[model samples]
Target: MKCALVLCSLSFLYSQICHSANIVAFMPSPFYSHQIAFKPLWLALAKRGHKITLIQPNVIVENNENITHIVLNGTYDILDKYNHVHSLVEGQSVMKVLYAALEAVMEGLEYQLTHPGVQELLKGEKKVDLFFTEFLLTFGFSLGRSLNAPMIGVVSMDTTIEGHMSAGNPTHPVMYPDRDMPYPLPLTLKERMLNTLHWLVDRVMNEIFLNLQDRVASKCLGQQIPLNDIIKNVSLVFINANPLFNVVRPLGPKTVNIGGGVHLMEPQPLPTELQDYLDNARNGVIYFSLGSTISSKHLSNTTKEVILKTFSQLPHDILWKFDEEIVSKPKNMKIMRWTPQQDLLRHKNIKLFITQGGLQSVEEAIFNYVPMIVLPFFGDQHNNAEKMVARGFGLTLDHNKLDVRTFRSAILEVINNPKYRERTKESADLVMDQPMSGLEKAVWWTEYVLRHGQTDHFRNTLSDIPWYQFLLLDVILCFLVITVIVAYVSFKLLQLLKCLAYKLYGKLTRKIKTKIN
Candidate 1:
């Protein structure tokens, strides 16, 4: 009897500790920057005792036991397969690649529905408990349906109109962190026109791809699919932006702004040579990196020489994150293939950051409060850079004008400007003061959906209302039309009465004159 009681107690304890539910986070693009943005969230969950799986093509993890990293090999090679895409030289924007990759993934999914690899993964032996992913990639929705689990979308950018509309939030360019409307509730005529134009562009893009997505999803899932409806049912959204970078606005529990979730790991000691160079230089250090995907080695020799020559003139110590090992690194310059970015950025002596303005780098600078000299290439980088410039935090450089003179001037401006440093510090302070770490907030809300197992809260929220209903413009237009009709009729009646009265007076005067004569 004693043995049986002990066994029973052990069994119950094991079950209680096993919140070790299965989760899969899907990112459509194979970009390293996007992956970095999500790394903290996955790592945090894995630490808390969850069985985690990250699915993408060519993904690498630092190798933790609690998490499983799965790479979908062939499906992701579309980045290289499209030769035209590779040949297209973009400066600093990533939008084109983002859009192209999304199209390719959707196409790949369609192809994979018939392929063995995708089929086997989707047909896993165990059911997934939660599906977490970037909302821009629609595959997570299908995965949620496949596993019958709740979905938590990780937004890679600020909540634009499309993002808000998809999440059932109000449609306006309000500051996300505080959820405050920067402008009036009812947009002015000019605002309405611009908003409509932006909305139309998004509508056109979404419409063009609907048929393609449907066909791809159906072929992959082995049945008919409702891509539109799946997007409509996301349970939670985690935006990768903090309130510090944005104006304060109201946000719901489901849509958490967990910006700066990228874990700022501590720095390891610098390599001896780089340390020696920095030690010798009396001036401060400057870090230059174009992010992960674009290899610095890919730059033409002329551009490389120009950059080198420009840095040679700067009295400051330089650490360049270059792809290839240089034949001769300068006495004051250190070229490294990789560095502990967050760790190095946190160093007090590091004065300036030359970045591609990718969201990950942007968030890091915001987290560390480091001043930036951005060279944006494409997509939201342009927008992100624009915001940084608008906020007085950084200087934007055109990639085409990367001549020595221009580069040197840009670097000098940021280094000299005390205001930029002050603003960056302010942003850092705001980012650090969040109520909960992004990981905790993300995990708690994800579990909340699992425990509840329904969408009652989201369903009742105003986000569920259709765009027409949310705007209430239809009702407003009807009221305006009725008011116009009533005013018009009243004016017509008054005009008619005045004309009749004048005619009567004239007739009476004529009769009196004739009688007197």
Candidate 2:
């Protein structure tokens, strides 16, 4: 009996060691928000005894000594460091800058796909059991397939693939729209038409544009490697969003919701100067950051003058994360190249935030219940800001019309108003109510896919149908033609019966007249 027990214990220990899987986390360069958002997740998995390899350029991984940083060799460091493609392209229109950035990322990613460094990483002897990568990379699907491992797409947006827009089950008012699932109840005619338009636009951008980008990127890899096919073959997708703030629906086994994990980032101590300022500001302080991608130095001199002048007028203290040193400083405004954002937001003295409306900043604001005046700088920033505005949690400001008067008014409105604070509190509550941290849920589902097998059902079924056929307009046209034919036949039969009755009645009338004469 003793000998049998020892053997079983040894077997169990071996199994545990085998289960300690290695996860390869691919971090695409050129976007600070993506890197920052992923930091917590990488750390969490490392702490849990999973080996993680972070792929990026100019990335620093400390504290979690267990995690390995695998910097990919690529020449797109210009896009990553300068970030001019995004922050300086539009001058004022943030979306234009955003679209340009996406285009640049697509272009740079294509270059990286063909780079010998990236190819070597993929073909390396180190066996990565699982893959965790951002959806923006687009080529991650290909990498995942090349490694013969399960791929989990980490989406910053609320749940839904670009192609799955109309599938969301829309509840009353449709607060948070998911890309897949049927709308809860039947929509009215007008609502249906509007939703159809929304679906069309979203599909074109997400499915068509992105899929095309993937193809182009694959071609850059020197031959034909079907990237879309690889994506279609993936096992799971992890969306970083909350159902409370977002619309929830039934998803297949492969997809999981894990959003709030950003808050789990290991908090670092604030610099003494910042801490002292917060202590001095008895009333409250305003936190302003345009995000890392958009440099403050890139803004036009006119706009900078307006912003600086406006800051001079504000009574509350301001902690501005400006990359370049300001020649002139306001009495109340202090500029730092980097601010401990997560730590500052959690501080009680921080009252309001001024941001570029990136998902990371939005998440931080919601996490801390800080009211915002969102100056959306591109991609999904407008959509996120619009949603925040709709929820009454904050205000959206157009960058084209940015001026001291407009910006000052928007700030004062958010700071003075009670509704924005109230809404922000509600958002905070919803974010914190999650049963598991976003990182935990993401890691769990990733492990689940490895334990089980290919979850083919999670893929979008529409991919099977041709683009034109998937629309189904041809079927609708056929049905209309059949209905018209049936109506015409019924009309012709009625006319023929009426003619026969009239002729018979006329003959009877004539015979009666002759008899009377």
* RMSD vs true structure, all candidates: 5.3, 4.6
lDDT of 1 at 385: 79
Each model's lDDT = 0.69, 0.69
Q: Per-candidate TM vs. native?
A: 0.83, 0.83
Over the full model, what C-alpha lDDT does candidate 2 score relative to the true structure?
Answer: 0.69
Worst 10 residues of 1 by lDDT: 174-183
Name every residue pair that clashes in candidate 2: 164-179, 167-180, 167-181, 168-180, 170-183
Off by over 4 Å in 1: 1-18, 83-88, 91-105, 109-117, 173-196, 222-225, 266-282, 298-302, 325-331, 416-418, 494-517
lDDT of 1 at 291: 84
Model 2, residue 216: what's the lDDT?
60
